[model samples]
Target: MEKRVKERREGLPELPNAEKGKVILRFAPNPNGPLSFGHGRGVVINSQYAETYDGKLILRFDDTDTSRKPPLPLAYEQIPEEIEWLAGFKPHLTIMASDRIEVYYEHAVKMLKMGAGYICTCSADEFKQFRVAKSNCPCRDNSSEKNMQGWEKMLDGTYSPGDAVVRVKTDMANKNPALRDWPAFRMQDTITNPHPRKEIGSKYRVWPLLDFQSAVEDHLQGVTHIIRGKDLMDSTRKQVLLYEHFNWEYPETIYWGRVKVHEFGGFSTSEMRKDIEAGIWSGWDDPCLPTMATLRRRGIDPIAFRDFWIELGLTQKDIAVPLSSLFAHNTKKIDATAPRLSFVRNPDAISVGIDADERMSSISVKSHPKEDIGMRKISFDWNERGTDIYIENEDSTANADIGMRLKDWCDIGPIAEGFSQMTSLEPATELAKIHWVAKGGASPATLMRPEGKQLHTIEGLLENHDFPIGTIVQLERVGYARIEKDGNLIYTHD
Candidate 1:
């Protein structure tokens, strides 16, 4: 296993400040939706660094906010599967913020007693005015003793949703407006957005914001480094202040700019949820979406996804990467193992007539021409007449009585509408080379290819349907495809 990881991680740039003791990292994701290719980067980088230092990796589900970004039950399990698929390793630990509610409460009380936090009952509009004016609110001046009473009121059900919150006492005049006494905890409207975890989601009304929860978890979980997107730099800054207020040292942090995959649209968990709920998408694994499930279903090698990010490394500037390059990388890894088959899309047929011959019953053809991928045999069941075969319209000759070869099968007369076959196994050198599949030897196959923002279905037929479904194969003259268990296909790439 160690050697496997090392082999997959070769040629990566050295991490900065590599000597941190017992390097511990955590990939804390909110379980609102299945992870996308963008999430793959964080999983691979953190896992690689942890392995590099012989440390541990944690999969922490930051599921505190059950109101706005409510958790999806499937996301809880789907995320880890995606991570393991991309990184080829499992996390050593799994944790949920909702499970650690009591711990956060204890920390919140401590902050309240320390005078670093206070309970504010201001309405949303009032807080916006205070933020715009860069001024303090009436709650900001409350003593710790008075704040303690308000805190009790919050816990005793005296405060309704949006009626009160606990805010950390940051500088009111800080240059960044977000830093000015941000709310630490708020009351969730459990009626509108019920918690996903029926056992505990609705049990608590007051919850810590992501900033406070993440900061506390980092310290308590023994995290040594934080790797995240540059867009979250503000989050990093906010967490730093929490670390300071608690008189604790902050963890090492690294931020990289956003990565744009040219083939996919941007990601949004809420948007995905809305689409799924509205039946706009089949599911997270729908070919039109770039979610990990869809990518896996397309027969893409996980190693290809891992290498793409590792080679890109941690850069400050955002990158616009073409998805074709990733397909190119995956092809190299699977070309030798991916078996080949014959597929005729929009098939055109012709009946070749010939005399009885033992050689006409079967023919052997290499699955892959240049590689030692073995071979497949195509057979004809009859001899009185010639073999009936089908070919993709695009690969068919427009003229009849013209000389043509039936791919690895046999020599044929001109490609026409009726049955006509050659008496010999040899074809003229000038015969047109066209892909053909013997009738009844191939099964109906449908290929779903992803377009800009929708899925396009193309009907076709595969010569060897006996191969187990879910097998990844290259259609001799066509692109690669992953056969569905039912014999359909999801096109990977050309």
Candidate 2:
């Protein structure tokens, strides 16, 4: 079953109306923070389709909302860097909505002149009553000239925040009340809540809502296809209405259901930002978090992410998966090259007696069991009587009467006061295979594992080697880890 799954090609379903070299897709993230694991699905699917069709992928920052979900300053650069890291190439085109405020404004004026939109001065409660009654607010019947004057008031700060808003004209009696004259643009007090961008700070009091901004940009950029979540189908409906007002064609859109990674369920970028500010987490790259930066720092290959998502394919059915499912893909990508080493946690010393003439002083084992990656030698502190080795304290307390084998080294008969070395290299019968390091031949190291919002550090002794920082190595009987600059290890997976 596993082999069949692996044999399947890693690609997404063919996009509808997609043409080779002409299919243009986009990934427009709000840039509230760095990309999360949920965001990765969109990135990978769009990137894979773009590559498959030999088309262009545009990275657009949909950062028009400055009051509710404000954009972070560092995200402008961090998001692009992450996209490059994951896709192995930069996006063909990059755009920021905040910088295109003028374009959105121009479209607003055009919509007003054509009587497709009107400025409403109704309060939130009054608008809700009107929408509930399937009726139009008093401002909805104003003439185009009157609406234009209201729009000018909005731009010139004549209307305070929430005093007036531009609403796109849609059917008031429409069954879905949300579609009835949805908000197109609103006023934001730039002094109390300024945009993060220096060039955009307090420059314009009127800001376009997401539905309006994204619709205009999609049409302007000639986006051929749009892939978004099913929750935003209403936004698509709203945008389609606006598209009709301009007599422009709406792009082919595909919607996917929410994917709930069991480990990162219910984690939002806003909550993460607050936690990070409170110092509950280190930063975006904190291993405990599920941000792309954290995944990269933990040594997950970009290919693994790509393959994982492509295998899931495009679906509207909501799916749930464990993090280990992703680790399985990474293990396949890295196992062949990750060198094997020994690590003993909570080590306890045990002496094994060997005859001077029959025992070897050291043993050299293949760095990888099935690969020609070279050999690593384990030196023993052999005296005239015996050699001392360190094993995990848990192993020392285990049943040792049957005997055990020091992996890749030698077999031991039994444990009385100490262990008695057996003559045979291989055990005659089944025995516990233990991973050990020669005393004085290992360095003290710490393995940090992220477990349920907490980072647990296990102090251990790792076999001495000059493995470069960022090298992923499998510790014998232990899981894989990436070597850190300080000679510690960050646990990757089992």
Q: Please provide TM-scores, in order, for all candidate models, with all chains considered together.
A: 0.93, 0.95
- Candidate 2: the clashing residue pairs are none
Residue-pair clashes per candidate? 6, 0
| lDDT (tens digit, per residue) of candidate 1 on 1-494 | 35453445455556666674588899988898888777888898999898888878999998887767888999988898888888788998999998997899899999999999899989978988998899999999899998989888777778887899999888878899888888888888665677898878568878889899989999999888899999889888888888889999888899888888887766677887789889999999888887788889898899988777887788889989999878888898888878888888888876778766434557778878778877888877664565677877765545455657766666676654565566446666777766778887888878999986878899887787456777888887778999887789889888
Please write out the lDDT profile of model 2 over residues 192-306, one tens digit for every residue: 8899999999898999999999999999999999999999999999999999999999999999987888887678999999999999999998889989988887889899988
lDDT (0-100) at residue 439 of candidate 2? 87
Evaluate candidate 1 by giving its C-alpha RMSD to the native, one decimal. 4.4
RMSD of each: 4.4, 2.8
Best by lDDT: 2
lDDT by candidate, in order shown: 0.82, 0.89
Task: Give the best candidate by TM-score.
Answer: 2
Q: Residue 365 in model 2: shift from native, Å? A: 1.3
User: What's model 2's TM-score?
Assistant: 0.95
